[model samples]
Target: MPQIPPPQQQVTHVNPQTLEELPAPVMQQIQPITPGQVRSARSAMEDMSAAAKTSPLTPIPRISSQTVSLSAGASIPQVRVFPNQATTVTFSDATGHPWVLGAPPYNSSPCATGGELCVGYIPGSAVFTIQPTNAYASGNITVLLKGLATPVIINVKGAEPSVKSKTVDVDYRLDLRIPKRSPDTPVYTATPEKKISLYDKQLQSVLDGIPPEDAQRLKLKNAPGSTKVWQIGDELYVRSNMQLQDEFEKTLSAIDGTHVYVLPATPVLTFSVNGQARDVEVELN
Candidate 1:
């Protein structure tokens, strides 16, 4: 009866100093994203991550090495280095062996002050990284390795690189063969132990299309042969499809049709073609 007596108008008191409870704010009408939209956003994020991971290098690293020989002597080879950049020199011959980089035999001007070039080497390996701070920096580095009568001397020089300057100068991964010594040649030097197996484990890297650091990849030009030649030291070796003569000893014949044979750096090789001996002249392309 009291409630029915009056539908009283509600009165609210407002206070400026004291806080008052207010009705909860209505949550924004949040539009929930559907599974497809969520998937699309996830896919976009994944694509971005993939792209970032597989981005191409600004300047692709290239192998531009040539073949050269190493002999026992005081002969020093020159390596070209870039200013403010590092160039690596690998003794492809002693890739897995231990070698010591002795104090550089000699250094000049800026190099003497240790400002022109900074030199370092990988542990227990004959790999050197030369960093040049001056554009015209130059110096000599001496290295001693087992099986050598004399130490290896490298001349590091600063150079300006061209588009085609990434050759052996930049890396110096050349075919370093000890100039063939005759029986009469009297040289007191330690030599690598004679290998008993024809299938040298060192060749596994070469068979996989990545030349072993010791293998000297021969650059061919206009050679008339399906065989590719790699010179490791003074010995000539090949991975070829040619049916070699019975006399051609092979270390491996992969199921992939690659037959590896080694020759004594000869100019001609005997191949069995059509069941006939075809004397193919081994020429470089």
Candidate 2:
């Protein structure tokens, strides 16, 4: 109560050395980034990511439309190789830039027939060689390129010499009669003229020459005379008569219809035989 009578002032004491030595707090300056600068930095990062995701270059090969044909029991057919024999495929990128290709494996199909046909390609080569095991039968040889969907089809033909024959009876009327009053008698006799020989190769050639559309309308028939004919709808007939004159006429008519065309006697494809060299034009799909 005695101290409350007057307001008392309190004095605080500070050390002079501590106050004098204490340093003032320093303010640090921080630079703020603008919206434009932030946008530019993000764009640069996106560009770098796109470059990292780019794919390597790849090349494609070229092939020809005409197929190669091989004969049964024949030596291996030599194929004309692509230029440089590099076996490197060439392809253009989305940027229209061309690139060379690395080596790839090949695949081949077995002969459709029971026989085996040797088929293969050399490393870095587009040309495929063919060799047949036997002359048993004919079939198609298929070759596949790795990474490609389409296949190369090579035809193999068997040229074995075979003749199929048939015989029929022919009747010729004789003028001689036994008695003056005896009724006329009819006699039937078989003749060599009725026999026909069918050549296998000739028949195959005719069938192969027929157009797909016309072939669907034709059917082979076995007649009494051993003669074969392409019968069309009962009304139309394309006969293979043994007579030379008739045969010539029939062949001409068949070719004129645009349904049949004669193939080479040796049945060769575009390439030459006997190790002849030829330039191959190939276009890849």
Best by lDDT: 1
TM-score of 1: 0.37
lDDT of 2 by residue, 73-116 (tens): 53322122221112211222111112112233232324344445
Per-candidate local distance difference test? 0.52, 0.29
**lDDT tens digits, residues 111-181, model 1?**
54656777765565445667777556777766654455566666777554555544223442322222333
After superposition, the stretches of candidate 2 with alpha carbons farther than 4 Å from their true spots are: 1-115, 145-148, 160-285
TM-score of each: 0.37, 0.19
Q: What pairs collide in candidate 2?
A: 62-284, 87-124
Report the Cα lDDT for candidate 2.
0.29
Task: Write down the worst ten-residue block by lDDT for model 1.
Answer: 189-198
**Which RMSD values do the candidates have, in order?**
15.1, 28.9
